[model samples]
Target chain A: LAKTTQPISMDSYEGQEVNITCSHNNIATNDYITWYQQFPSQGPRFIIQGYKTKVTNEVASLFIPADRKSSTLSLPRVSLSDTAVYYCLVGWRGGGNKLTFGTGTQLKVEL
Target chain B: EAGVAQSPRYKIIEKRQSVAFWCNPISGHATLYWYQQILGQGPKLLIQFQNNGVVDDSQLPKDRFSAERLKGVDSTLKIQPAKLEDSAVYLCASVPGQNTEAFFGQGTRLTVV
Candidate 1:
């Protein structure tokens, strides 16, 4: 399992873009970086995942640099509803899918 | 498509009591996971199951925590002699196969009084 470190909390305004970065210095070649969004009292939902370069989806975009040691999740035009706890996980799927989650970055989007 | 299903959305029990939570993963998913989320903290992986076998339960407190996924369809997590610190949300998630994102259920909130 690759240890991930991210910001504890962040504050943003509505209709603004928020970028949360996570660093995993020991990421393996087979490991992929995945992000999940969680709201109060609800299970986390998948946001975006990437192995290298950039992967864009409807909700967010994941940018992985050449080193693969760090990745950034960008939420474009985030709304108040996007305020949630975002977790960054780095792991592989083989023998046992052991996913280690970090403290996560509590994103606060206000108007 | 239906997602993961968990019953008894909320459970309240006294200390020294036992409680079990159920989880039905998405149809055709071969992998299941159990996670515990405490207040003000991120979810932690407690156990992982592939089909009907246990993959990992290193973080699970074996003294009181036990889980099973028989027949490889649904799973149940039980806590014997619960403690006040056992109060947390138990989450169940599953994925279609390898290297894919996991789908999570609403989770079961257990409160030990």
Candidate 2:
């Protein structure tokens, strides 16, 4: 099974860029790194997914180094609504792969 | 596009009673998942099903919890003689295909007293 570890919580101010890092030292060769964000009283929403290097989208950017042992999710110009729990997951591509979630990083963006 | 659908939105049952939750995955999705999210914790995978066949249930407490997917489209999770510890949010998710991101439903909040 693939396991991920990240900061239990984080704090930031509105308009500040927030970066949440996760470590998956034992990730397999075929695994992909994915991130999800969950707000209070709602299910998690997929933030981004990447295989390697830097993948940038409108909401965030994912940076995966050559080692692939760790990845970073960067949220630019965040607002109070960006406060949520973010999860990092490592899993294979096909064949009924499962995800084992960690405690996740609780990002609190204040005004 | 529809993400995922689950009901009832909230359910409260006394300990030793039974409760069931349902999930309808996005159209054409081939994989479904059931998760248990306790307060202040990440969602925990309880079971995984691919096209009506269970792929994993190692974390599920088989002594009390059970789940099934019909025709690989819809699923139901049941707790018999529910325990207070079972109070939490039951979440459902679906993946379109290999190497894709998952879409989650609003979830059913289960309270056992």
- Candidate 1: residue A83 Cα off by (Å): 0.5
Residue pairs of candidate 1 with colliding backbone atoms: none
Residue A29 C-alpha lDDT in model 2: 94
Q: Write the per-residue lDDT of candidate 2 for residues A7-99, one digit (tens) a residue.
A: 999999999999999999998899999999999999999999899999999999999999999999999999999999999999886746686
On the 0 to 100 scale, the lDDT of residue B108 in model 2 is: 98
iRMSD for every model: 2.0, 1.5
Specify the highest-DockQ model's number: 2
DockQ of each: 0.62, 0.70
Candidate 2, residue B63: Cα displacement in angstroms equals: 1.1
TM-score to native of every candidate shown? 0.97, 0.97
